[model samples]
Every structure is written in C-alpha cells, then in structure tokens.
Target: MFLDRVADNFLTQLVSEPTREGAPLDLLFTNREGLVSHVMVGGCLGKSDHEMIEFLIRGEVRRGVSRTATLDFQRADFGLFRSLVDRVPWEAVLKGKGVQESWTFFKKEILKAQEQAVPMCRKTSRKGRRLTWLNREIWLELRKKKRVYDLWKKGQATQEDYKDVMSNKRRAKGNLHPLLDVGGNIVTKDEEKAEVLNAFFASVFNSKTSCSQDTQPPELKDRDREQNEAPIMQGEMVTDLLHHLDTHESMGPDGIHSRVLRDLVEVLTKPLSIIYYRIIES
Candidate 1:
C-alpha cells in the first residue's frame, strides 16, 4: 500500500543464492523516469553483509570564466612620453579654469602621452605555468603522464603505468593545495571549512550596526575651513606625490599605472601643477 502511494519500482531482482535468499538486501527506488542513467552492484567491503551500489546521473556542469588585459610595458617609450608632457602649454591653456576644465586639459595631455608611449593589448590570464615551482620540466612530465593515461585508457598500456602516472598526478596536486589558517582547528568537511573561514573574516572586518548617541558632530574651525578649500598645488608637491606612488599596484581600466606617472614625474610635475593651480583658482 505504501509503495502504491509513492508509485516506486523494485530495482533489485530476487535471487536463489543464500546471500540474496530473502528480500533484496541492497535496494534502489526511484519514482522519476530517466533519472538514474546506470546502476552497478559490486563486492562487499571487508566483512560487510551488504553489497556496494553505484549510479550515475545525467546533467551539465558550468565552469568559471577568467579574463584580463595587459599593457605592453616592454615596448613603452618613456623619452617620447616626457617630450610630449614638456610640450604642453600649461600656463597658457589651463589658466583661469574650473575643476572639470582643468581635469579635461590634463586628461587630454596624458592620453596623448599614453598613445605615443604605453599602448595596451588584450590577452588571456595565465597562472601556475609562470610560477618557479611549475617549470618546463614539470610541464613536460605532466604532458607525458597525460599521454600515458590516455594510452592506458585506450587499452594500449599496462595497469602499472596508469597507476604510477596517477600517483605522480596526486602528488603534484597535493603540493598545490592552499594552506589556510583555521584558528588551530582541523576541518575535514568542505562546508565546515568554508563556514570557519567566513566566520573568521566576518569577525575581523565587522562594522557597528548603529552610531552612538553620545558621539559629537564634527565642526569646521577657521583653519579647517581653509584646509577644506582647495589650495594651489606646487610643482615640487606633484613631483613628491609621483615619487611616493606604489609601483606594485595594477593599472586601471584607462591602462595607466602609478609606475608610469612616477617614471615621467620630472617632465609632468610643472604642467600638472599648473593645471592644479587653475582648478584651485576656479
């Protein structure tokens, strides 16, 4: 009656052997049609009474996409870049300008310099192969192993060769697994490990839900007001700013880097400062 309510089928057949004498010990029940692609029954583990059952399901899996753009820094012409910046008439063009106007002029000049010096090109993002650990020898070994695996799967190689290749592959993968700090706890399950990591990061960067009533509002004094109002930026100040730019950081969508600014600081400082002064006046 219960089986009628569910409308399921008995997947296992009755056998005359003693091991399968009574009811089907290993049973698989499915209500949905075409759900299970294939079923397999294998030997029992160690001294276990029940047999091992395995099945495959039909579906599609999606993979993540990796995309990136890179600048042709090797072919960059810094000398021409400096010459372009030096040729800009900073005093004549950017004088008596608004913030937007000054920005437009400076941006135009920078774009011209970039067009001449640092041209950008697109390419697929690469990893692992570039690392010192995964060298040419390792790559060759991996290729060879893969070829051997294919051959074995096609019944052209011995079982021992396939096992050896698999062992090497496992060893290589083991070396690449990221080591995470989980507060001295050993997490076996992936879900538990992810939860632990999420909790740790949440605690570190947690923000207050409400502002305290006791906190006072900020008041601008005379000096503070003067500081708030834009001041005339000097050539030396621009040069100093350029010198302090971080070289290790990546470029923006505009394909310009702080390293490029720093490299051309000597030529750009005076022109940039003039543009800044115009913005301050406006």
Candidate 2:
C-alpha cells in the first residue's frame, strides 16, 4: 500500500531527455515545497556522455552573526582598582549581616570595583576559526597557492605550475589536522570528535565523586568532610589563593579580572574571609 502511494506521488518525470545517448534518467526530484526552483542540463566535461545537471534552490539562507562582550585588559588600570577597593567601607557595610546578606553586599562591592577598573567592549565572534597554529605565514602561503591555482584554471599557467601550487596547498592543510584523543586516535567525524573531547573534559572537571572515592576511606569520611566544611576561611589562605591567580586569564561576565583581585588581595582578604564565613554559616 505504501509503495503504491509513493509511486503515485513521486513517479512523475521531471527530466525530459536521456542524460546519455540512451536510457532516460530522472536524477532530480522535487516535492510540493518547490525547494528546487529550476534545473539546467548542459554538455558533460571531457569525453563523458552524461549531461551535467544544475539545481537552483529558492531563497537565501544566511548564518547568524554572533557578538560577545570582552574585557579590554589592555586599557585596564590596576592602581585605580586598588583605590576603588580601598574606598569601600567593607567593615561597616557587611557588618551585622546574615550569610546571604553579606554575600550580596560583597558581590555589589566587587561589581562596583569592576565598573571603575575594567572597561568592556563588544566585537563579532570569530566563529571559533582562530586556531593557534593558523598563523599569518600559513594564511599568506594558502592565498598564494589559491591565486596560482586560479591562474592555472584560467589557462594562464602550465600543468607543472598548478601541480606545484596544489602540492604546497595540501601540505598547508596537513598541518591543520583534527585534534587527537587521549587514546592517541585521530577523531574524524565532527560530532564524534566533539563528543570525545567533551566527555574527556567532563571527567576531568567533575571531581566530586572521584575525589571522595580516592581521598577518603569510608570510616573517616564523615569526620574529614566536617573538617573540610569549616565555616571560617583564613585571611592568609585567601591572600595566598589570590596571589596564585593567573593575571592573564580572561575576565568573567562580571568584568572582574584576576589581575584586579591579585592587586587588591592584601586589602580584600580580611573582608572576603568575613563574607566567606557568613556564607558558610548561612
């Protein structure tokens, strides 16, 4: 029954002539949507007898342009940031507050500090094509090769010249192969490659289960957990953590860079520790 319906709907012929000398072939098909507006049949290339078919798809489809907010680290002023933090009356503002209140107040102060210190700029996203290995030299070589190939195609260059340029182009492409997995296998398909990469990273970043299993025995786990969950974060510990922060790391959505925190660590450690204790208690 399904075969009869399909035959009734799709058996209608679109092409009028045989692609070759004999045996008429209907290579193109279109439904009621009219996705393919028109078709062109032309002579085959070289010594081939089959006709070349060109389908014209209706309407235009374009990719969406993406933009991202990025911090202007080059124009940042760390000295001004220190002054901004110093101006804040953290003791008076955050005193006599519950954990949530203290956290909210601390966040507000940090935001204020960020506004004064960091500037943000919006730019079109690069579509993730800015690979570390795709440098200017390689791009220039690729452009040169493309120009030579185009010239050869237009009959301005000889076969030898075209082959040489193509060889160089292939070598440039070989340098930009897909990323290898931890098992040293080259992932080819885009979806499979992305899944492999995401799975590997997920295992690395998800440390809760792994840490509990490896670091704590069943008998002492509860006691160790209690100790680990102690409310008070020492000022020295906060300062040490701040000092270890990478200054070159990118800023978060709040526009606060590690450089800002690192610079004002001495002034912020005590107040931050108080807030941390409040949050823990809450």
Candidate 3:
C-alpha cells in the first residue's frame, strides 16, 4: 500500500540487499535516479549483525581550480592592525635611518600586522556555476518530467503527469527592480541602460588636475645633491596625494585600494614618500 501511494517519480529505493536474514532493514532512498550506484554488500564486522553497504555517489560536481588570493575587507580587524602599528616606537626605530631604511622598517611592521588583521582568501572560480535560485529539488523535478515524457512516447503509460518543475519568483522580483538612471528613473530600453553604463565608465574625478600658485607644494629642498640633480621627495607631497585619492575608485595591481590608503594616511605617508623618492631617482 505504501509503494502504491508513492509515484514512480517520487521515492527511489537505492539499497536492494537484505541486511538481516532476508529482511531488507538497512535502507537508502533518493528521489533523483543515478545519484547512488553500485549497491554492494560485504560480511559483517565483529559483534555487528548489519553488513557493510558500499555505494558510489555520482553527480555534477564542480571542482574549481585556478584560485586567486584576494583580501576579504569585510572580515578585516583594522583595530588590531592599528594597535600593532602603535605599539612600536617609531621615533626610536627611525632615529638614525635614511629614507629607504625608515621606509623598509615601517613596511615590514605594517605588513606583519596586516597579515593577521586582513588574512587572504582564495577566490572561487565561477566558470561553470548554476544560478542562485536553481536548486536540487527543482533539478530532480525536471528530470522526472523528462522521464515521464519518454515513457509516454514509448506507449508505456496511459496518463503521465508532473508539476512544480520550474520556478520564476526570483526572476520576477529581479524584473520588478530594473536599472535606474541618474535622476532615479527606471530604464527599460536597452539603449538607455547602455547610456547609463557609458556615462559611469566615462566619468572622471571633479578635482583639480593641476596645481595653481596657492596650491603648489613648496619646492623640494635637498642639499646633498650634484649640480642640476632633482631634489629628494618631501613628505608633504606624499601626504597630499594620499589625501586626494578617490575612495570610490577600486584598487590597482598592488592590492592596496584607495580607501585603505586614505584610512591609513598617518602611518603610510612617510613610507609612501620612499616609494616616490625611488620614482624620482629612477
């Protein structure tokens, strides 16, 4: 009677072997076919009446490779990083050091702190992935429907039926919220959406591109130099540049984003000067 109630689409009894004296007690069930295969039985272990059951699980498993290391900023503990940097006596550390030496010391310490505060995570590849809304039960229903159709084609059934095989709720919600324009109007046309993206990509910072008389940094002053040799980098310029960095912009190849640089301006200014110093020297 229980087997009569269950449709051919629903429960699939995977384990066919009888565990104790011709009574099939040990069981395994899966709604989707071909998931569990090669049902095997072995002799029972010491003091155990139930025999060992072995089966291979087969399915669409995506073993992603080519992972990339990236900073997970959400989990970063900036307070820990700041405390680590503050515990050091910078004045003593950079007492008699040159620009390069001082920068090196700061870089070492900051990197050490950053390692613990912002640990790296391996980014998973999305080459071949399913949509967020598509789940396992939906997939099983699709397969069941397909099997019912095949059975009907072969004249094996009088009436074939399956329902609830697809879902569009998420897609309906997605369509409800379309792309908006600058003035907060929903854009429906493809051309309008394209225009919005083009406008965003073409936009640049509104800040001044050049320095006028009032804003020009004081000329670099380095006494230890050959004739006509460029002056050494000043801390003021480095600080100014860090301050002007647009937080909205994403990070470059160095993995250091504008927001992080601006946030750590005080600690990074001197070390950043060394970076510019080498550039000018080169």
Leading candidate by lDDT = 2
- Inter-residue clash pairs, candidate 3: none
Off by over 4 Å in 1: 1-19, 22-25, 28-38, 56-62, 66-92, 111-234, 248-257, 279-282
lDDT of every predicted structure (CA atoms) = 0.66, 0.70, 0.67
Q: For each candidate, what TM-score against the reference? A: 0.41, 0.41, 0.36
Count of backbone clashes for each model?
Answer: 0, 0, 0
Question: How would the candidate models be sorted by lDDT, starting from the highest?
Answer: 2, 3, 1
- Per-residue lDDT of 60-160 in model 3, one digit per residue for the tens? 87777746676667698877776777677765676556667766776678778888888787655652265534445667766877887677677774452
Candidate 2 local lDDT, 88-168, one digit each (tens): 788788778887787677778877877777788764445234663554667787798888878889999998998877776
- How far is each candidate from the true structure, as Cα RMSD in Å? 21.5, 18.4, 19.9
Runs in model 3 deviating more than 4 A are 1-59, 127-236, 246-259, 270-282
> How does residue 29 of candidate 1 score in lDDT?
61
Count clashing pairs, candidate 3: 0
